[model samples]
Target: MNELIPKETPSLPSLPETVLPALDRLVSALGIPRTVLASSEEIEYAWRDLPRELREIPAELRGELIARMCVAVSTGLFDGAMNYIWNAAVLHLRNKIRTFGLPVVAQIRQSDFEEKHLLELQDSKLLELCLKLNIVDEDGFFFLDQCRDVRNNFSAAHPTLGKVNDREFTTFLNRCVRYALADSSSPRGVDISSFISAVKGPRFNHNQSGIWVQRLNETHDAQRQMLITMAHGIYCDPNTPEQARLNSIDICNGLTNSFTASIRSELINNHTELVAKGHQDKHAASLQFFERLGLLGLLNESEQHHIFSRAVERLWTVHNGMNNFYNEPAFAERLLEVSLQGAIPETVHEEYVQTVACCRVGNGYGISNAAVKYYDQMIQNFSPREIATLIRSATNNNNPLGRRVLSGGSYRFHFRQVLNLIDPASVPNAVNGSYIQLMR
Candidate 1:
């Protein structure tokens, strides 16, 4: 039957009488079936597609493997040709990786990436390494990985499941060339060692910081996140130099707004762990680190309370010290800014209300003229509950805030002006008598 399986080799596409004469004689003597090879039609089809595909490869890449592949194609051995072409593509990929700097790969991976390790990597793993280092972009990785699968299932490199047609072979070869065999001139991985050194070394002026920021902009997300988290760690380290902290903050402020949710969660975890471990100095610096980035809202209420209470205590201490008038304005302004980040939490309610009252009523000498405006602004923003506390405390004899107002004439007048800042309706009914008395 002409349509029978294997189709009696002569019925398949014919090969030239002169071609493979010696091999044909040897196979005939050994009783080997010609059907074991691809048909002449398949070989012809492969040749038609081969030249166009091979030309796309860099001329330098088409050396021994390309030559062997041509031999295999002429002999109608598509499997062996697939093997040779894949080998060429893989060899090119490896060479490209070497050019991309293994030291930088080690840094991005956060592990050592020596030459031997690269050499010993299996094909799939080599592709994975390229993906992580961004040697192959997402679309490139997707297609190259498919080509690897085709090579494994249909190539001579392994026990192939079955044969592939010429069109399938060309498609596989095309993908390998397009994705893994491209020029390696573009990707430059971020070097972790020099990155850490630059961040910890000198302070960054505009152009200096801009250069490093540009470098980070070109890297992929994984390395971007790692570097940002590293910068946050450096900033929060209690033992870091002030200038290093400044540099780290500069780097983080540039990157934080673009942070993925994962990065934000990681930063929150680091800050919370410091608090849980009672690393007081790190916790304090971490607070400022969050504050400087305008991320105070990312912190929990308890952390916000601590920041508020501590800021108030510092301002109160400096307000009573010898250089009170000269030193108080900056601290007062910072406290006002921190308050605007979130609502005052209940944990620091008393101190928050009374501290502003104390600074407003002044000491035995006089109020800080430079600090008074910030205090007046804070007074105007106090909630009804805080207003109630402020009014009730002025009548309590044991309260330092009350004692200050009761001590002198100018104190009483400044306290009255502070009370006038509140809308009458915002004052609670229970504290109405105390409020009226204070305003008078």
Candidate 2:
């Protein structure tokens, strides 16, 4: 019976005399129950995990935020902690945006925020703008969204019917520290600025160049874009020294290689999603992505081969009965112009030739013409055996598509000439006579 007596909960440590008025005012203004204020023990427990940099947050708002968070956690007022985190995160993001210069701030406000009402945006809108500006990546944006949801649904600011828990509040608080406050350093932006200055000034020595390349390789996708854009600016500047321009070009090429590799990986990994979206959408997306790279002059011969090979594979495998091979013609033409002749893998080349042989008018608007043009451009690079194989493949059964491709078109004379050079014996006497007549 004695052991059955209930024990009283321990009281929280008292607030300092100086801070008591502020805490009382905050509770009154926020309209939260005084019981939400935490014990000193609870505040100490939560403080252990607080980021060091968070303590450096400016004195004005930081004190209020820290006090509220401690109270909220100690008193099981998770919603109050969430609200405080949201305010602090928004303030941090706004400060970061202002540091990016007026041009960037104006651009984000115009594009992502309302022009006249930009200042009126709340936390969620601010986070959305940060996301669009690449100030925050997707995962960071997601956590911020969760914080917003919890604040809106469970905090004292709203009329909540349910309560949040300690785990939820702590998770949101850690994310705020990690994604919002921690990002204030801007080291990546500084590195990009330094690299641009180096590239614009003079040619880098071997060691310097090696260091620059390594840094560029390690950057995140957003930073990679900034580096590529800066390189392009240097490459296009007429006053740039030849050595500097050449170095910029090399950097752009390497970055482009990284870009294309990631794009290829994505295509491979998301093939099912792309297929469900239909080939037209997938083709358009791929072409636009590669074309942007090409315009930057980052699409190298090897990358062209890679993209063309993938395009050919999709052409063969995916069956869109509408017969619209969207963007194939443009891609093939670009591949022809950029790809190093004779560098295509044997398997890819074989598939490409076969694809062209089976071509019809609607499969892609100008695909047949593009394929024929590529073959003509690359004919000289073909090995004698490859040329012979192509001639045999085209002429066997008088392949109508092949015949159409080779007979009296833009590449007709060139195809005939290559045929005569590689394997004259394979060219029938009638075909040779017609070629001679066409030449006349």
Candidate 3:
């Protein structure tokens, strides 16, 4: 079992008083006019300033004018405002926001290219102003430390994808959006811009816009990682990550029938009765069994997280299913004639039978009587002793996997025999019963 521990916290940074004003000036000087109508003290005093000429204005009118002022600044309406007035107002607001202890500049263009696109200029004059101010650098815009990488650095690039390698899932999202527009013969660029604007509101500054995009990209990258991990876990090994396991559940379910066949071929060889009667309908019966076993909650969670935590539980299910094949009296004597080496553990037959009966074999999609019979015959005909020795060696170990493999192998051997016999009518009833119930 693994133990978790808490990490030590790091020291907090000492915030400087001048940082806010400097950041505010940096952004505002880049052609975005800052309008500071009132100082923090003035605004606080405005509440008491009510009853004066400013108070004579209706509250609704005052609100409208303030909103209008914001819109005008955002849309670059008061372009003729004196440079000194704009700079002074910006400085005041910077100090006001800083006094409250918030980051002055959340985002900023780090490179020349980023700055050019981050804040789309409304006119050539705005671009000229930005250039004159030297706001745009040589590369992209630099954001605050809150930003995280969204791209997949580990995955190899798709051969046909050109330069799309390492990009985050948002890159795919963008592609999908473009595809959808093209398919519908719709106006794309404008519609996409509008959609983005609706999602993140109109971009007040390039810095804010960059931050928003980066945040979204980070989220998509996380989801993509989960998906990739889940797919690998279910198909390759049970010990995979929880997120990956959960993602692979549907794939596992789809492959259940084939897995069921493999289980049957490995478990109840040469049993015609077991074949005829069939094992319980796995999907329905196994689900009900788990519910009765007080394991339904875990089962559901496994369905959600890919059941890696219940490695023991899954082994039990497999064991139980295999034990059903062994109880068949027809197969009991037939084992003597077959090569029993690798087929089943001669020394611990009783324990093997018990363990197999307890394993949880889910919906019949994974175990088949025909397959079990074939394995039984193969073990008898070619390597029964090897199979038996395998069982014995597995049993001697402390690894829970030892028990799991012994149980699964025993079933596989019998399953091979059952299939070889191919006479469903002669199948064993003992092999059809769950060993779990028998033990109980």
Candidate 4:
């Protein structure tokens, strides 16, 4: 038979003979299960923090063992040898649980808790740590400032806690009802600001479905007729203030498809002339208006710009050659700059015009004139052949100006001529002497 050797698994270290009994006593008091208690190796790892014995193990091994000890302590398991360290770990985990969801703590109330409630609990991790360590009593409420406050209290007999005893258990539940209603912490609360106003009555006439009408006709309505008054203010028979117009837009943005189409159509019918008038930054404004009108997919970038540009042109014509009315050069330049921030392909003259006018990319040489002088300065230090290759590459990369220069063929001839002067031996094999001749 072939020789067989048994493989041994890594064994936990033995607890020190003198400390073993005391360690066992601590574990018993903490109510930690024997299986969950830190192993002897974990205890040795914790002891590595002692100065004299620190050098006995590799730093990586020390970190690994410490992490294992921490995991045990976080779950309330302590192996007596590292009681202080275990206490600190529990405190840290408690703090962590407050700002983050804790599997153990979250499981305590399954029915009442939600993802958002869990997130709120997670945010109070440090508070949880305080509760775990008994550093702060649950009844203590800490006022952060005028805007906010933190209340930590252990309520054992909360309505949600039915049947669960009012035992002297420590709990820190931050009572932030006002802030919670106002805060937009969760994705579901993206429109929290408006949502809060709606609940507070007449302030936000949120529901479009005659709910406001039904409330107004109530026999025993509130002390004041605010809802009816606000309704009258909104539909003042003829004139709605621009501020109200903007508020309606804000409300439309806040809503999630409830009467959105109706509201948008009403706004358009009332605001068509103003929108078509085209204000400053008409491209951006018009684009938003078109989106509201559900006409966004009907246009492309160039088409949108073209429409705005034409409208501006017409507005200018209507006011005569004054140019002060609309389509001002400065305005067009700003719109063009915004439209062409990154750049697509354009012709040579167009690119140069854009570059010089500060609309497109600028040459690194700081020369502004899109003429032969700048090109000459660019090739001053470089070989003509190298310049030709550089220009050729730029052209191939869709630089319209480069294509224009190369199309002339004179620049290439000049480049080859310059290469001849730099390396005479290579010039003899030249397919064409145009570049070399120009350099010479």
Position 396, candidate 3: lDDT: 43
**TM values, all candidates:** 0.62, 0.41, 0.17, 0.26
The numbered model that scores best in TM-score is 1
Residue 148 of model 1 has an lDDT of 85
Q: Give, for candidate 3, the lowest lDDT window spanning 10 residues.
A: 140-149
Measured over all alpha carbons after superposition, the RMSD of each candidate to the real structure, in angstroms, is 10.8, 16.7, 24.7, 20.3
- Tens-digit lDDT string for candidate 4 (1-440): 98864323223344456564556677789998654444554445433323222232223233444445434333323332132222232333334334333332333333354445544543245444334322333542132121111111211111221111101110110112111211212111012223223433343444632343333232111111222223223432235444453433344333323333443444444334334555334334444544433343344556455544543343224323442323233443433333332222222323323222221111222212223233233233333344344333434526543443345454444434323334444333432344343444
Lowest lDDT sum, 10 consecutive residues, model 1, at: 4-13
Candidate 4 ranges with C-alpha deviation above 4 Å: 1-21, 24-37, 46-191, 194-440
lDDT of 2 by residue, 248-319 (tens): 766654555576555444433443344456655443443434344453133345445566687666554432
- Order the candidates by TM-score, highest first — what do you get? 1, 2, 4, 3
Best by lDDT: 1
- Kindly give the number of clashing pairs for every candidate: 0, 1, 98, 19
What is the lDDT for 428 in model 2?
53
Evaluation by lDDT, superior candidate among 3 and 4: 4
Q: Candidate 1: what lDDT?
A: 0.82
**TM-score of candidate 3 on Cα atoms, chains taken together:** 0.17
For lDDT, candidate 2 versus 3, the one ahead is 2
